[model samples]
Target chain A: MWKKSSDRFEYLQTLVTEFQDTDIEEAKEQVLANLANFAYDPKNMEYLKQLQVTDLFLDMLTEENENFVEFGMGGLCNLSMDPECRDIILQNSGISLVTNCLSSQREETVLSAITTLMSLLTPLSRSEITHPSILHCMLRFSLSESPRLRNLAAVFLQDCCTEEQVAQAEQQMQGQQTAVGIPLPQD
Target chain B: MAAPVGNSSGCWSVPEVYKHHEQRKVCISRPKYREGRKEKAVKVYTINLESRYVMVQGVPAIGVMTELIQLCALYGVVEEYRPLDEYPAEEFTEVYLVKFQKLTSARAAKRHMDEKSFYGGVLHVCYVPEYETVEDTRLKLQDRRRYVIRTAQNRAREKEKQERSNEDPTTSDTTTTTEMTIVEYDKTCDSDNTGEAQQTSYMSHYSSFPPLPLPPQEHNFYGHTNQQGNIQTEDKMGTLHNAIINTKQQLQKSTSFSQNSSDRDRGTEQRVTPNQASAVRFVPRTAHLENRKRKMAKEATEISLTDVSGKNEPLIGPKLPEPPKLDMEDVSLNTTVSLIRNTMKQVESVPDLKPLEKKIKPRRRI
Candidate 1:
């Protein structure tokens, strides 16, 4: 069984390369379909996960965007550990992908994706988030028409706001100790 | 020799298609099927990204269809890049950028590739029809999307029916009970799967989080994801990837291609849809952006000091010759607090010094 999976792993790497070939469009479909079957099958999924094949699957597939969204949250969560994986997600997927994932009509899936993307950022990146467009998207995402989507985007947006709020809270605590009334400055 | 070209700094094998400025050949060392050969870890793929997207959707209206031109051209192209100079000569070419972009969305990109032959595939080389605007692209995609999804949906239903028929008769009879269960495959979740993405919201602490598992249902979620998210995610990623590849290919295609290639869409800004705020704009939470916020905070402190310094001249100058020094500490955090504490300490110490001064001054005066 182990050997079979290892063989499949080796085969998947080849499939990914072959999938890249321009002439193998049907083969590409077959490869992804096969991988998808493996991905969807619970028995295989356990072994695949143990092998940490999600990362490879992400790398090899390179282009299964929407399918990835369902477990995007989990993918992002898993990627949070592997810095390279996280960077690839951010770089390839980018903010647009992030936003689209958040705003997806598939509320539960996109919510997880959005929140997970937000988590993937290192603390430094998390603190400095300032894309005004992201702010706008967050609003639309909150109105995601799906409660699950709304909450997910909200959680993500709130996470983005955390650093600023943390700084503000620290500032307010300092003001209370002073002799005279010191106003807590707002940004 | 004069320009000084040779092996790159890395020890591993690099997949170079060519050597000199003249003849470019990519010597990609295939991974050794045998064990223990060195140079196996180097990832030769131009883009080291895992997984891309494909979304195919019915454009409800021609109005939305108008957005297709931008979508068609810009969807899967690499948005972030340094420049062509960053890559080794002939070793890297963007010729397949568009086709590779289709890889992001298997079906949607495939559909687009079907219409526009970016390469000489099994069917023979074909040219993608030109789209001028989002609407043009959308109209084209809408027509294709409608046909694709319907066909896909039909296929999916048939496949499900077949699978159901193949199941054990005893289990099939229990329509209410599902024998299948959702499960996690590995340490990582596809995250790309929208079904599992929904539950990720459960972890809000943003620390020690887990990944989404595959969704279990009557329908094979993966089977339908192409029909569902394919045009959306796949089409976008494929177009964008193609745009990047095409840009490179065109540069190689003709001298005129450079002008067109340089005219690559400023899709970066358009692609960045800030959460909840297309009206407000979304800021990516990256380290540089975070550091920028810190710098902004520091600047705000300086501005506040400038204002306070402007007001401070009259009230502090005469009484406090050291006012400038204290004012200097205004914008700083820890130091400023310390300065204020020291100032208050000096104020307390003043009374104690007066009695000692009285004794010393009287003796001196006498």
Candidate 2:
């Protein structure tokens, strides 16, 4: 058991290093995606935390490459499922970074962002997560054409916030809406 | 902005095939250390990419829809199914939409049935999130989130328990007290882990205490079926026996296929079992069949004996032995005996005994 754990840790460390050292965009994306997928398994959570892969994922949010942002958000979405990882993300100010991806053109990135936001909820972070602008973003998502996005956003509203908050957000949405989740036109 | 590649529409429209439905090229250039158990495309799966609704294409249009659905039911309860008459299909092949009761069932079906041949055609299965109502999507995400949290919480408690056991040997005597303290600690420190903790401090909030880990054998009960789906070999009583138990489970779901495939499944099991290091003790198929036949014959006699006694018992006294008394040793046999007894009593109690006996006597004679 000890040997296997170490082997897994080492394998993850290799992926992390390859992700950093590789200049090829495709290899980086592949490694990023592999690490994100590994984050899905609970057994790897401890090793990922130890390797500071959480910070690695957080850094990708600010990258110019959209794939980096999407995969990074996806990793965070998986990692934040664990309470410890959620705390780590909260400490790192992950909400704003994730919240930034709410407006990403890619639906997958937006979906991951919303889930990550829901997972990042704690007594301290709940207010920030359900802040009116984010709530407004979720309200927009709730009306999305895609059923997956609309359903996920609906869950975020229903489970992570109060009916009063939702009603207030709805009332406010009619007056002045933030483009927090609205797509910006590309050149 | 690129239109997101998955289910980008609602349920009421013509199901447009999405980009995710196409199988991507497998990644082969990975260095030796990173290859998975199966070669896979470099794709990340988030909850958005999965759904309880799956679309299966490339079914041979040979009017074998019943067989196709029977194959699907082996994975889980197929909630609803209909052939997608308007959707595009490969020349001479058809497409069908299947809604599973659970996303996990759909996932299992896709994993097991995709690329498998049925009626001379291979199947290509992919999630059709486009077909989900908003409620379906909500429940799917909620369930996935809850499952992940549950598994995480269980792992956390297990780690804490191990740490406590290792930290002090004296407290081992007061395991219940130690557990209580841990639960107390969880309530105080890990309050955020429970989604409801901030809402209300009800006693039910303490139910998050980890369930006793399932026994190793019972692990198969919780949908670890796929992991153990492959048949194995065990040297019971020093003979190379074919263990086609998992295939038996699949066969039990669709009995029509069981007749021919029982032997074929056994052959597959033996062939798949790697490396017979023991001096190749080849047990003849006929011998195995004979052994099975003898055991079946013994069971048949036991069943017949119970049936005779069940009918001879008068209605007044404890109307058939306590269910335990009718135990046929196997659960399935016991169930069958109870069913027979119940029907027999029903026949006796109703004022229709003569006609019932007339119907039953011909079958008994046969």
Best candidate per TM-score, number? Answer: 2
Report the C-alpha lDDT of model 2 over B1-366, residue by residue, as the tens digit: 111123333363566666678988988877776765567787777777787789999999999888888888777656567788888888999998887655666777787788889899999998988677655665455445445554554554475467566776653433443344345434433332234432232222223211111111111123423312311121111111111332232223222212212322232232223312221232111223433554465456435434543223211212111112223457676566667655654644431121101111112110
The residue-level lDDT of candidate 1 at B55 comes to: 17
Q: Put down candidate 1 lDDT per residue, A1-187, tens digits, no spaces.
A: 2246556555544544454453544344444433443442223332333333344334322234544443433334333323223444444433333433443434333444454455344443442232333443444444332333344444444434444554443343233224233211110
All candidates' TM-scores? 0.26, 0.62
- What's the C-alpha lDDT at position A183 in model 2? 21
Off by over 4 Å in 2: A1-3, A176-187, B1-13, B169-366
Chain B, candidate 1: TM? 0.19
lDDT of 1: 0.31
TM-score of chain A of each: 0.50, 0.91
Query: How well does each candidate reproduce the native contacts, as fnat?
Result: 0.00, 0.17
How many angstroms is the interface RMSD of candidate 1?
A: 25.5
Q: What are the RMSDs of all candidates, in order?
A: 24.9, 29.6
